[model samples]
Target chain A: MNSNTRPVADPRPAFVENPEQADQQQALGRRIITDGIRTVFLVGCGGSLAAYGPSVYTLDNRVPQLVVQAMNSDEFNYRKPAGLGPTSIVLVGSHTGTTAETVRAIDTAKAAGAESVVSLTSDPESPLATHADLAFTDRPTKWAWDPKEIAMARITQGILDAAGLAASGFDEALAALPADIPNVFADLDPALHRIAEDLATKPVTYALGSGPMEGMARAFAMFYMQEMLWRHAAAYNAGEFLHGPFEMTESQAPYLVLCGEDATRPMTDRALGFLNRYSEHVHVIDSREFRLAGVPDGVRAEIAPIVMSAVTTRLAQHLEAVLDHDLSTRRYMFSVEY
Target chain B: MNSNTRPVADPRPAFVENPEQADQQQALGRRIITDGIRTVFLVGCGGSLAAYGPSVYTLDNRVPQLVVQAMNSDEFNYRKPAGLGPTSIVLVGSHTGTTAETVRAIDTAKAAGAESVVSLTSDPESPLATHADLAFTDRPTKWAWDPKEIAMARITQGILDAAGLAASGFDEALAALPADIPNVFADLDPALHRIAEDLATKPVTYALGSGPMEGMARAFAMFYMQEMLWRHAAAYNAGEFLHGPFEMTESQAPYLVLCGEDATRPMTDRALGFLNRYSEHVHVIDSREFRLAGVPDGVRAEIAPIVMSAVTTRLAQHLEAVLDHDLSTRRYMFSVEY
Candidate 1:
């Protein structure tokens, strides 16, 4: 089932060679703290937004004194947060460096008097990166998410250190990712294929995850299940699933619960317990089942989404196998032009 | 078409008579600011989460000195934010005051050494109200939402006053709701039926809105459309809609776009521009179309969700008419144990 589209190898990040930009970002982080900056807005769209999921999940724990808000790029362009001007920094990311909403958000942030506008994109020549006050570029790849994860970890640690919270930083934990990320694909789970086979026949599918893993589950449901396979699917936060969306659960309802190592495991376990009673096809992708010996326990809790992403990527591949649907097929994405 | 189960009469809130609780809530709000509270956690689940939409939308615009984070009750219970205890007040509201997750969260906040636990619920006997350090109760209603809005406005204004930012408060503006709210149903919208009829047959529907109205659109799609009619519908914030859900849009795909008059209108309008190209069955519930003459221009931009909710209530009734299905019809709600 492996095709040319499948990311077959681990791609190196371009930023590794460009240490100057990394230093500048760290300096910007220190400046924010020194200037008494009250807010740090992390803005992006789609996969770019999901890229920051881990940082969003872990930043507060590392720097409780800092206020961080993750904003959808377009939302930030319109609903400019109060005091977002000279007192704040707008950190944005786009893969192609051509995501219109993100480019516009950078312009909007500058106009709103933001002290700094920083961007992360794959294409250095792309407007999203070229027009920013500070921009970091990486070579684009469909399957490689480690670059973004590393970039975010660096930025997060910078801010944490500037806030005098280096003792609680995640630098060492993130450094272990280069080795651990590759190991996620070394051993394949056959249950991933069985889950895909069950979901291929179901018209609607739901994904559930706790804390950091929630965003990864959402990306799988939307990007893989819906966009890749053209299946009706959506992801809900574990706690939210216990609220109204749980009503949709029925006998044989297809559900993929991403159980990661986190403080919220009890909540996800509770949700899974209830889901077990309702659906025969309820499948669990528990990180506990995996042997991620390269990653430390402390970092394991935060990077659960990255691990889930690696597993779901396999599920997406297997879905292509059983459904006989090409992962590249699309009616509207790049075809008819929506 | 209105039946016995329908709430045809306008239910006035009991808060008008019970001003003491409101006064106490105001004092708590001020104390939160005066005591140098660094974090304000707004927590709830389901409709109660939507109830805080406007405050969540407009609070930062008015009170830049304070930090506000809206959290799901269950999520808060497990993944407690780093700065949640001692210096933070968990402001929670539950209509029935007996939701287990929210009740558990109240206990969690107290256990975490929260400076204050303030609650707003209708059932005084419920543990949520009884166990709170300060609790405000309103008489229950099936359709009315003004009491919560008024209460939030008062609490928000008190916090603003303490922070020396009360000049931008909307207390008087929200007071106009009891008068303006009744007028929403005085004249029904014909477009509501047209939208409902077009949506009745679709297997899946999407609702999009910005800011406060985002929550309203979500409630209309999930609670009203899915829960009441057993139709598949979901809502996305305008910016979020552009990210991934837009991939689902196709020719004739039914969409209900809630165009509210707020700072985020441009964002929603941008999304609508793209949705218009993809779906012919796009429907707009523009607050600008309403004659909300009683609502002041200043506050009209803030309460678009409340206005949209009024029209959506009408749409719910019309959907029952078009589908020949009762709004109360449910496969398992209250009838089956989960």
Candidate 2:
């Protein structure tokens, strides 16, 4: 497939035609979130929950009084920690609402006297939604490059709106995303493609970053690189990169760093400089431009990282596709216990 | 060497015997933290900050007025986000205290008007410590294990004490850790040793858990399996294990899960159950016994997970040693760039 063309397996429908549906869902999510809940608890399992961390951190920092907890439903239902009260608002995210523990969590929260529940899921009719006070459907088609990115973008915006925080910028960002992402990916495609192509034959790979982006680097390196590309890859934070990982770097070894625009930028730059000193195999996705200049005014700079994250990841998906890696074809190595 | 035998290179002597020194350094850290008046930003690179997430979350949730921000210093210094004041506290951590970016972060924080600096380092003479207003030293000789765990325990206690909250039990728990950890590791040594021996030749491994223990599992698996053993490994929360990892769980893959005594026990159990259905090649370090029966009573159950984390990790360390892995052989696969 050509770099600019959509993949043959493009499963997601274009968002242009469904403007009304997106707006309605966004409005509903906002209403549910803004209505009388002093604190918000986002609950999910696995990647779903992992994805919520940045959003939670963003929202929590923006509105210090808004308590955001990323609790795995399985843990909440099983461990039952103290401090939850009737005033707490529970936001549950499960791609498939059929996740048993998530469904049980909603039920448990209601029983425990939670004030409200907001469910984010791909399946509107999933059990969690059925029990939820409000549900935000995340229906991204499988072939939309990175479906989770779009889903998380929407979910994050909805959560922010619900908190009475300004989310129009995020809404605007996502609306322009389909157009912006492809360009960003096109720009970085060559580098990532080279990395991906080389990674295809490598026995191992590492993705390094610092700050909030560490989790992203890890997810991509471990999940995408290993799962999609079937390669051995590891992720490290820029600071920790030197503690022990530097010794593993050599002329033949390749690593990628996600240098997002954050306080960690300088440190990451220095760390990357050190890496470059050791070997020329290091590649970095300089996110400073998108991080500082890309976001529209009035949007919290802290949250800008989220959008920049979207762009970088979009590039990652293109690179993966260029390498002809299929995410669906990979089978999970282990069954989820709960 | 027998499991009971200590390594000749044990670095514990330099730090452990000098509790008063540690206390003095901690006091200095508190002074820097307090004197750095504008904002208190807790900067850490990767696992160092992540290990402190729960505590940061707690502080943010309970004391919103503190102006505490946990970020990777690498991002902070480079991005140069405005609002950093001279009174700001930049708390950075680098085990060796020589991470280039971290050192730069201290410099940037100072330039940004950060008046006081505090650092956690295994090497008291490292640049980060030398430059800091206060520094906590934890000079562990063995690279196989991290002393940050102890530093974090101390830091968390200090935070609690500073906040005037009830922290007596937590303090006691920290004191009891050294003895408890070695004992638990000795008991679980045989099982872990056998598993390590079997997996010595394996190319990849996965560590699974949920809740706070999830981070611990990831840190250990990545450090031991990837760094020490030079084998590939990934860590995932139990709840997410089934999402994409199950496919790799054929009879050939090796998986380890840490089942700590936390609210996630049920989820961990459920995860274990699911993994059992897919494959029998799973190992577990059940930590409930240590939490419930072994820990002293005054410690809060909420903190039990943190206390028992040492035990579980010690087991992992023993396993690596038993498998004839050299704890000091440092491998660098990549360097961090700013």
Candidate 3:
């Protein structure tokens, strides 16, 4: 099922053809947004919730009528919000939908006066999905280990759409995703393979970005270095590199900066320029190089980075497997009960 | 002046008596809030900003009218927020009020049409305070190395007051802060010192929290472990521990949880309970144990954590210093150019 030599064409096949998953995701989105809930709290772990950082930024900035918080599911039930009434919505994200923390979160939300609950997952029968008022599944690819990013993006867009906000641009971006992602895989495969090979030899690697991309960089660092490669990796903001992390940048340890769109570009350039002065170890992945497969008109410019980051990350994962590193050993995993 | 053995009644004498510094911080706060500003953006570094997290949470939940972002000042200016107009107010924080990033942030906010800027600092003529429309200084006690917590709490309350909301509760909370904080220091000081000693010997340490306290956990882990101890300290949601970081928790490198007052307290307790089952190395800080020195009536229960967390952190810093750490080291300082 896993091949190191063959180039993976697309990693989302399991989700694309699975009708059950699609229905679940849509249902979850609808229940949370259209159910007359005053507040929506989304919970997940690692990439599961980190994937929603862009959406969190968007909702906080654009949606004044709705209050949204993206938190780890384990924390949801334990540190429950004070004012969550019966009209509140709680959404949990778990790729397996069986994560104990996520399940507990759903239960806690239900107990707290949350009138509606939704789950975004890859498994319809998972404990979390089974307990939710509605469930959205983005079929988990058997060959791929994690599908939380795609599931989250789809569900987050659905939530926005259900809230009466047009998500046509998001839909268009996602539509283009399947086709556009292959190109990134093609362009990044060799570089990723090279990095993976080198990662085996190096002690640490730094993943850096600015703005919303900081979360993406962190996800990559956590998923690839900590989980897949079982190596030590650090995530830093592009502007913060000079503050202290820059000292660690020598001929030995290198850094990768995810220079995605607009405001982050300049910071990326500046960091790259500064690092170039010290050593030739800094690498940048510019967002402009990739075309937005297809985005709707009037889509906020800020939203593009959300979709693009997911694509960049998926490609980075392939690099991890190609290097023949362990893909399941996580350095830090939060227990759901806590 | 530097007596390791002496039990000083007040460690923050420099701050209390420095009228010049007080004038600077007050001026900064006033300038940013009242300078015909349509929106206010707050920026700070790790400790300086962590001190302000609760206030940011309170302001966001209560005011919602003013835009507040707990961002690194460097990132704020370089990666400006979309839709920022000429009447925006930019507020920057620094212990010295002269951090390079804060200086650049103030300049950037001004360039982007900030009607007025404010600085919270310990130094009256520090670059950040000097450049502001007004600056507010907390009494320069050594214990109050980073007074931004009080400064932010007051400023946020002032904004609420100006916006026609009653701020007496917030003001009363601030008044009670001085009294309640000492007990936290007395209670946690010995434990933190011992932990610092243990951490100083270890290769890494991890700080964990959930909900609004998540930001505080990150700030503490980064500053204490990364900046002070120079050890690899990671911060994560209590829920995320099981997803990945838990894999690394052996009998050796353990995790620390900063349990703040929030909905996730039960979860944190459960997580701590579970972690104890696995390893005896886990440490927990229940923030509510310390009495708030001057809490006023009508103050929302949610706002208590913000002030309490601030007090807890000041105590943390004293321990960090005893561990032979200072953030002012050359590697930690970055030049600000705007």
Strongest candidate by TM-score:
1
Top-lDDT structure, candidate number: 1
lDDT of each: 0.74, 0.60, 0.62
lDDT (tens digit, per residue) of candidate 3 on A1-338? 13444453344432363545555665565666676665667788866787677766566544545556676666555556543558677778877777777888877887876787777777778887788877766554534423555555565666677767654666566556556656655666666556655555665677788776777788777765665555566687776655545544556656777776655567677777777666566666666665555654455345455545655455556555555444554444432333
Put the candidates in lDDT order, highest first: 1, 3, 2
| Ranking, DockQ, top scorer first | 1, 2, 3
> Alpha carbon lDDT of residue A244, candidate 1?
68
User: How many angstroms is residue A189 displaced in model 1 relative to the true structure, after the best TM-score fit?
Assistant: 4.6
A294 in model 2: Cα distance from truth in Å? 10
Cα lDDT of model 2 by residue, B234-308, tens digit: 677787665545545666667787776655667678778877876667887776556233355655444555644
Against the native chain B, each candidate's TM-score is 0.88, 0.78, 0.78
Candidate order (TM-score): 1, 3, 2
DockQ of 3: 0.29
lDDT for each residue of candidate 2 in A1-338, tens digit (9 for 90 to 100): 23443352332333332455566556644654666555556777655665665665465445534445666677667644333557577777777777777888887788768887778677677787778987766565423433444544565576566666754576656555566555555565566566655655566677777666776776676556655555566677776665445554567677777776554555467668777877667777776444233345555344444544554455446545655655546554333323
